[model samples]
Target: MRGIIDLNSDELPKIQDKNGALKRPPAGKAAVENLKIDAAILRQSLVAQAGAEIIIYKDPTEAVSTGVLGDVVMMSKQSYFETFEAAPFALVADGGEVTVTPLPINRAAIHVDATGGLQTASGIYGLRFEFSRATLKSYPSIEDAIMHAVVQGLARTGDAVLTAGIMAATPAAFSLAAAAAAGVRMSELRGLVGTAGHGAAIDNNGVLRAAGIAAELSPDLSATIVGSFARSAVMIRSDVEVVVDRTNIDGSLAVTAWAGLQALLPDTTRFWTVAA
Candidate 1:
């Protein structure tokens, strides 16, 4: 076996620049052992994505009482006490009807503790919730074309054909066989949901079919499938932005990694602005 005993370390430069400016290089053992950041590299570190700007404070009691802060806020604000069925998610609208606001001291003769009051007035607050990995690209203006290929290729060869067909459809559809298969093999995925959440399926095909109710899949559950597979499949909410994480600032909301990417078409679809 070839060994590293005689390799020359002097030829290796501290950093290398490709197309951009000379930037900070990754830290090495020497710098890490010394508990030091290479100042030379720190100065040129590149930012990945812009951070959100909303900040929100929740009632600790409510946060602990309910499994979700977003749901608690919705129930308290909307005046509903029913248990949530679907997983909780939130959206920080841009100062509109559903704008974020501080909790009032009193509501319907009920007094809210000052400590747990909404921080909208005192400061900014943002909403947060969990998102499926399949929907991660829903917000960004990128095509799943590349990701679709990578994910499909990594799966069975038939998955590549299924993915291509789905992507081509107006509202993509996955056959029952495909959906069941994806759900089963979901454990083996690396580049998509499985990798992001560690064996989490994120229910990509199932969720997408559920969301495509009015389009790709017939809303009438009785609709028959004449495609490659038999049996109609269930649908998930595609356009629904599951609030994963958020911070609110003075009424403005900063959302965290909301899952799912909106469709790439731009020809006046109803789900366009809503998803955007």
Candidate 2:
């Protein structure tokens, strides 16, 4: 008895092996990991860039307490307290009269009104390659585009917050001519801060442009970005979130970050104008 041969076995049938059916390839794990690393690096770079532009006060002398208040956040400020003088007591030489001088009372009180609300600075970015012609060509993947957008947004947010804080402080002004050195703008900034009784200084491109006392006097003060934090400094707390959607062929990504800017001593902060 001859066994029957199935011709259909050799022929490519419409329905192949049920167990070996063709399916879409799963997304690669390496690709996802690479994207994550790139995104983190970009985020960090942006943060540093923003930090350089603005003065963030994180003085070790002061203390910052963080807490939540309803939908808002609160940061309590405790000023640095110190007393250098000692009691009036002097060593007396044998048979010699010792002079006694009254001790001076020096007290640096924490400003009761120093308490401030943590101001929220947020940046949001969306990456939709289908809708973005520029991104589609420039970025190798949607993740790359999303990362760049997120970084840019975060940097901008930081810059804006710092700028506003400096403006509000409104320290005194110095002259560009009075600048200690030609290339060193920070020196001039230091002078202004010293005059305003602040110990710290911030000099950036924005400050350079704002250079001028006349500009500072204007109702819309627009002097160099130089300013002083006075006895206390500006503090910041930040949080970041990122999301990616791979449900469709044309996927999307989104990133958001929030930074809270609070002054250690709201009343102590001062801004200055740098004049030519």
Tens-digit lDDT string for candidate 2 (15-74) = 212465432211222221223322332233322322232222222234445556435434
RMSD of each: 23.8, 19.0
- RMSD after Cα superposition, model 2: 19.0
Clashes of each: 42, 11
Best by TM-score: 2
What lDDT would candidate 2 get against the real structure? Answer: 0.35
- For model 2, the superposed segments whose C-alpha errors exceed 4 Å read 1-138, 175-222, 228-238, 243-270
